[model samples]
Target chain A: MTSALGAGLEPTLDALRARRSGIMCKHWETVEAGLCIGEVAGVDDVVMRADLAHYACRNNRLAQLGLEQDQFAAAVGAATSRYGRRRIGVFLGTSTSGILSSEIAYRQRDPHSGALPASHDYRHTHNSYSVAAFVREYFGLQGPAFVVSTACSSSAKVFGNAWRMIAGGWIDAALVGGVDSLCLTTLYGFRSLQLVSDQPCRPFDAERNGLSIGEAAAFVLLERGDAAAPGNVLLTGVGESSDAYHMSSPHPEGLGAVEAMRAALRMAGLQPEDIDYINLHGTATPSNDAAENRAVMSVFGAATPCSSTKGHTGHTLGAAGAVEAVISALALGNELAPAGVGSTRLDPQFGVHYLFDNRSQPLRHVLSNSFGFGGSNCSLVFSGAAP
Target chain B: MNGVRLYVDGIGLHAPGMAGWSQGCEVLGGRAAFVAEVPPLAAPQALPPTERRRVGLPVRLSMAIGLEAARQAQVDVATLATVFSSTGGDCDNCHHLLDTLASPDRTVSPTRFHNSVHNAPSGYWGIATGCRLPSTTLCAYDATFCAGLTEAVSQVSQTGEACLLLAYDTAYPEPLYALRPIPHAAGIALVLAPKQSERSLARLEIVPDAGLPGRMEDAALEQLRTRVPAARGLPLLQALARQQPAEVVLEYLDAFHLRIGVMPCI
Candidate 1:
């Protein structure tokens, strides 16, 4: 994942362990929210190869940077060699897509004619499937590919899609992840909704105001369990539910969230106590944190340790699912439960055990939650292979 | 593992001259004529007054077709999960939002922002039906229909539950239209069951292979299929119209086309 916390898994893990946040107060070009952002630095400097120039855009650039990090591309290549390109599916998620590219084109319209610049390649760049198409071509894979754009739950749902496809024998292996880059629409749009915190986000804090909008690109390679090494992590279960209560607001009591968690637990065939740590979808917004807390408490009780990594990496919108999934996998492998930065004091009303400091312990099963604007909720369960 | 076989019990479609399943079947079977002009989409009665007014053509068409499929299948909409796929969801809403951002005012309305998410249509469906079942929204550009089919088929086989698959796309306005030119609004809905029941209309076997699907005889119908992503479901609609067993391939990934072996139970 690339954010203000630096690139790749190692630096991100180091930042999380050292309690170094990536969010910083910086004014975006046109946005005046004054809210801190978790923008990936040097994004403009990162360019695509000449052959991939057709897919050039800020979003794809971030995706390219993400692919280059942590030897993720190498892993994907190895999978391609094993499963053959035609047998590996690509399922990615994104929200704004390359709308930023369009946003730029809108400014460069012909002064009199109002025609957009000819350079705007909407099909290959701005389309919702652009990232998936680009990745498929980048890795030279010809398998079934699509993009899931259900807001923030987009990426988390990829795991479920890949799992179902593989289990049904549609594909031998799959690349499931998301890449959502920052753009004016989300920045101003969230600000217009009054959901953007002017300061760095403080999830679960008593004084928490709103979320700090961020961008991220994170992916994971999923194959048959037999192909994975003994110590590699495994995705045990995925649970999804639509709140159907509101378009932008979650259920007041988190009934949908509870259902999603319960479903995941049922799928995994594990009890609440079986979970070691939970990466909360704590976006730092008042209603979001409160609603998620109710859901977590109802499912895992106050005993299960939980924290929102948004405080560390900021809320990466559609990419949060995969970003937090990577964080959960990193925590499981490193045996370090990341603490909630910036939330020095948890809200007294929330009954869940919200962690404020890192804990060094043997983590076995971890659950990550991602809920989105349309009340779309998805929870994923990941287990350490050794344990 | 062999892919699970699914029964397509109900089909719904909205296009230029094809309004409902009956009309679509008629046109596909050469009983009714095809037109190339864009038709006005009907608003879904299932939505509340507030949502009915707020939603655009995409949501209305999706709901209209989805309800028709559910009705034909003789199942409660509340009992089924859904998978909604579109190449560009609510392009009108996006164009308006982009216009607002491009304007000097820059402040967007809460409703517009809320409706901007690609899954807004799925969210509205949930609200209208009060169904808490899983609903996923996906896109694969022009291959959206086939991708949605793959997802819905996998879901029905995995969960042993009936699912509604809706693939829809509408035209984008000027500036953006010049780039990705989708001329007309179209949608296709299907009610897929894990096992064939008394209501089953046809059976579908989805396999991975490569080949171009047979072109529609009517130049207008073929034009619609080539231009609109959702209209790629035309071949399946035609098979349903024939009321006989047929085999056809649909666009999927770059190297692979979804080979569907269709059999009409009636």
Candidate 2:
């Protein structure tokens, strides 16, 4: 994973353990609105390989940076050899999808005719499927590939997608993840919606205002359950739902969120009590945190240890699901309970076990929630390979 | 990947010259001439007035085709699961939003922002049909149609439930047009079920194959196969158009194509 919190899992885990945050005051070029941002440091310095020059863009650059980290490429290569490349599918999620490249191109259009600059490459860059195509080429994999762009829940839904294909006897294994880069549209668009915070977001706090937009890239490899198990990690269950109640806002009572969590638990054949840790989608926005709190309380009864890592990494948009999925795995593997950092005082009224400090505990199954615009909602249950 | 077979129970189509299944079948069969102008999409009356007013071309096109497929299959729209695929979702809306963001004001309208999500069409489908089942939106550039078919087939096989695959693409306005160059709008909706039913039209199975897929017979339709991402399903569409057992291939990914073997059961 590459995110504002820092690159790779160790750094992100270390930051979470130290209760550190990566958000800073808004400073992105062309984003003048007074809002905070979780900028992935040194993205401009990351360069794409010459062979894959056609896929060069901020999004793919971040994806390459992510692949280089934590031996992700090596894992993919091993899977390629086992599955023969054609048998492995590539499923990724993203929102902006290199629109920044076009945003830049739009500025360079001819003064009079408005003709875009000759250098524009929409297929390799701005298209939503660009990242999946780039990853497929980067690894030389020939399997089925596509991009899921359902807002923040994009990445989480890919797990369900891969599960269906693999379980239905389509693909033996799959590469699933998400990558979203900071762009003017998201920063300004959120600001226009008044969902941008002036300072680091304080998720689930009474004074919680809005979200701090962030960017990240995270990937995972999934082989059939019977295949050689790479590690002790397993994606046990996934559930998806559409609120159908509103466009940008979630269902007021979190109807979709409740159903998604319940459905995931049902699919995993586990009860809510089996979940040792809950990674809240807590975007720090007033509506999101409140709605999620109600949904969590109704499901877990305010007893389960829960927190939002968004305080550390900021809300990574489409990548938030996979980033948090990794965070859930890290917490289980390291036997640590991540805390909601930015919230100095948890909101007392909501009455959920909102953690504000890290603690060591024996973790087993963990659930992560991701909800997005268009009322798209997804919940995933991940388990350790141990008893 | 294993071969997952699904029965195509119903089909809905809307394109420049094609309007519905019968019309599309006629056009694909070379019995009718291709028209250059795309048919105008009507605002979906099934959707609430508010949502209907807020949607753009993608939503309108998806709803029109999806409802038609559901109606033909005699399936309750409220019980359907959907996968809506598009190369560039609501390009006009994107262009409008980008144009607004580029200006000094930089504040995007709420309606435009909400409708900008790729799954906006799926959301409206849920509202119009009152379906809460899982729905996913996908994009694979020009491979979007094949990807959607793969997903729909997998969903049907995995869950033993019927699934709807809606593939559509719209032309981008000027600046984006220079890059994508989609000359016209096109969309296809298929109702796929796990097993053959009274309404089943054909049994379809997709397997991986080497090289590009089969092409349309006419040059104009062939141009559509290249221009519109959704139109890449022309081979399968033509097979269904003929209402006979046929083998067709679809472009899926680099170095791989989806070889679809269709056995008509109508």
Task: Compute DockQ for each candidate against the true complex.
Answer: 0.83, 0.75
- lDDT tens digits by residue: candidate 2, B57-158: 998899989988999899998788899999999999999988887777887887887788888898888778778788999999989998898888888887
lDDT (Cα) of model 2:
0.88
Q: For model 2, how does the per-residue alpha-carbon lDDT over A1-387 read when each residue is reduced to its tens digit? A: 989988899899999899999988856877665668888988888889888888888999999999999988888888888779788999999988888888888778798989888888888999999999999989988878899999999999999999988887667889999999998878877877889888999999999999999999999998876543444688888988888787788888898899899999999999999999999999999999889999998999989999999989888998999999999999988999899888988877798998887989988899999999988899999988854
Give residue A49's error in model 2 in angstroms: 0.5
**Clashes, model 1:** 0
Most accurate candidate by lDDT: 1
Off by over 4 Å in 2: A228-231
Model 1 Cα lDDT, one tens digit per residue, B1-266: 46468999888888888888898888898887776555677777888898888888878989989999999999998889899999999999889888888888898988899898999999999888998989999999989998999999999989999999999999999889988899978999999998889999999988888676666777888888899999888988898899889988887766677888898877
lDDT of candidates 1 onward, in order: 0.89, 0.88
Give the DockQ-based CAPRI class for model 2. Answer: medium
Q: How displaced is residue A369 in candidate 2, in Å?
A: 0.2
